[model samples]
Target: MPQPQPNLTRRGLFGNGLWAAVVAGITGLSAYLFGRTKQAKTVWQIDPDKCVACGNCATYCVLELSAVKCVQVYAMCGYCDLCTGYLDPDPKKLDTGAENELCPTGAIERVFVEDPYFEYNIKEELCIACGKCVKGCEAFGNGSLFLQVRHDRCLRCNECSIAAACPSQAFRRVPADDPYLLKGAKESKPAGESKGIA
Candidate 1:
C-alpha cells in the first residue's frame, strides 16, 4: 500500500502567504513607480509684469538660441500706425520699411486695425530673443509686449539656470495644472494681487 502525503502543513501555508504578500507588494510598488515616472516635471516660469525687456534673455540662456520670445497682447494694444516698437528708435520715417523698423529681425508684423489703431503680431520664427521690440513697446507703447520661455525648449531643471541670471528675479514656480499665469481679460486691482508671478 502507498502512504498518503499530508495535504496541508503550517510551513506550506506560511510559504504561500509570504509569496502572495511579496507579489502584492511588488505590484503596488510598480504601480506607484510607474505613476511617478509618467508625471511631467514642473519648471520655472516668467512673470511678464516683472520683466524689464533688458535684452539679458538673449545671452543668459544655456542654449545657443534663447527660449525666450516676445509675445503680443492684442487686447491691450493700441494698434497705432506709428508704433515706436516697430519703427526705428529715432527713425525719420515710421512705416513698414526694413530700415525704419526697431526689431533687428523684423519679427513684428503690423496690420491695419482701422484709423489710429493697428494690430501688431509677433513672428516668433524670426524672433531672436534680443528684446528690442519688448523694450521699445514698454517704453513707448502700452507695455503689452513681454517675454516668456517656451516650455518645449525649457529643460525644467530643479534650479532654473535663467532664473539665476535674471536681473528682475521674475522667475517663479507654478503648479503643473496651472502652468501659465497669464493675465485675464480683467486685470485685478486688489493690493494683495501683487505677490504671485507666473
Candidate 2:
C-alpha cells in the first residue's frame, strides 16, 4: 500500500514567511547598531591661542589627574635666561633652584643651552595643568607656553568636564585622527596676519 502525501497549506507558508521577515529585521537592526559603534568619533581639544590660563583645567577635570598639559611652542619661544614661566614672580636668585621654581610640581626643566639662553621643556608626568606657569609666561614672556588636552591621557568623555567649565570657551571638537591643534603650524596665518598687512 502507498503512503498518504502530506498537505501543502497556505497558512504554513505564511507562517514561514513571517518568521523569515522577523529574523531579517533583527539582523538588519544588529548590523546598523554595530556600524554605529564602529563609527569614528571626535574628541574635545583646547586651542592654545584661545586658552586663557584660567586654572579651570586643573580643577574642573573629572579625572584625579587632569588630562591637560603645558606644551611649549619652540618657534615662539625666546629661550630667555630669565624665563618668567620657569621662576616664581619674586625669586631670591635667578638660578635653577627648587625653591625659586614657579611650578608646584617642578614640571618645567631648564637645560643650559648657552649663555643667556635656556631650553625649557615640560615634564608631562609631573604636570598638574594648573596654568600657573602659563599665566606667568603670557604675562612676562612671548606666550610660548600654552595648555593643551593630552589625548593620550584624556578619557574622551561624551561631555568633558573641563570643556563645560572653561571660561574662554577654548574647547572644540576635533577629528580623532588629528586631534592636536599645534602652535606655529604654517598651514594658517597667525592671529593678526593678513594677506595685505605687513
Candidate 3:
C-alpha cells in the first residue's frame, strides 16, 4: 500500500508566500537604487588650476573629437603683438601664415584690436584640443589660455575617459548650474604677476 501524502497546512503556505515577497522586495529596491544612481549624476569640468597641459585631453576623450577646447581670459590677456600662443618659438615672421603659427590646426585667430594690441580667439570648429597653445601661453606669456571641457560636445559619460588619463588629476565635477571652471571667470591678477595657475 502507498503512504499517505503530508497535509498542506495554511500556515506553511503563508510562510512560503512571505519568503517570496521578501525576495521580490529586495530585487525591487536594488533596481530603484540603480536608477537613482544614474539620475543623481554630476557634470564634468576641468580644474584649470591643476591642469598640467599633459596632452592627454586631446587623445583620451571617448568622443571622436575630444570635447576639450582652449579658452582665453581676456581680462588676464596682455593683448601682445607677438602672442606666444599664436606663433611658434622664433617664428619665421610675425604673420598669420601656417608656417608662423604654433597651433597644429591653425585654430588661433589673431585680430587687430588697435595699434600694438591684437585680440586672439580660438576657432572651435578647427580645434583638436592638443594643448600646444595652452603650453606656449603658460610658459612664455600671460597664463590666459587654458583648456576647458566644452559641454556642448561632451557626452557626459558616467566615467570620463579623459579624466582617468589626466596625469595631474585636473578633471573634476561641478554643479550643473555652474559647470564651467574657467580660469578667469572672476578677476585675476595683472599679467605676469604670478606664474601659478588659478
lDDT of 3 by residue, 1-198 (tens): 976567757888899899999999999999988876632445788878889888888899998889999988898899998998999998999989999999999998999999999999989988888999899999989989999999899998877899888888788776555667777663442222112121
* TM-score for each candidate, following the candidate numbering: 0.69, 0.74, 0.77
Q: Best-fitting candidate, measured by TM-score?
A: 3
- Residue pairs in steric clash, candidate 3? none
- Candidate 1 residue 44 Cα shift, in angstroms, is 1.8
Q: Which portions of model 2 show Cα errors greater than 4 Å? A: 1-39, 186-198
On the 0 to 100 scale, the lDDT of residue 39 in model 1 is 30
Q: Per-prediction RMSD in angstroms?
A: 7.3, 8.0, 7.5
Indicate the TM-score of model 2.
Answer: 0.74
Q: Assess each prediction's global lDDT (C-alpha) against the native.
A: 0.75, 0.85, 0.83
Top lDDT prediction, candidate number: 2
lDDT of 2 by residue, 2-107 (tens): 7645665788879999999999999999998887763276778787877899899998888898999999998899998889999999998989888999999999
Model 2 Cα displacement at 24 (Å)?
Answer: 16
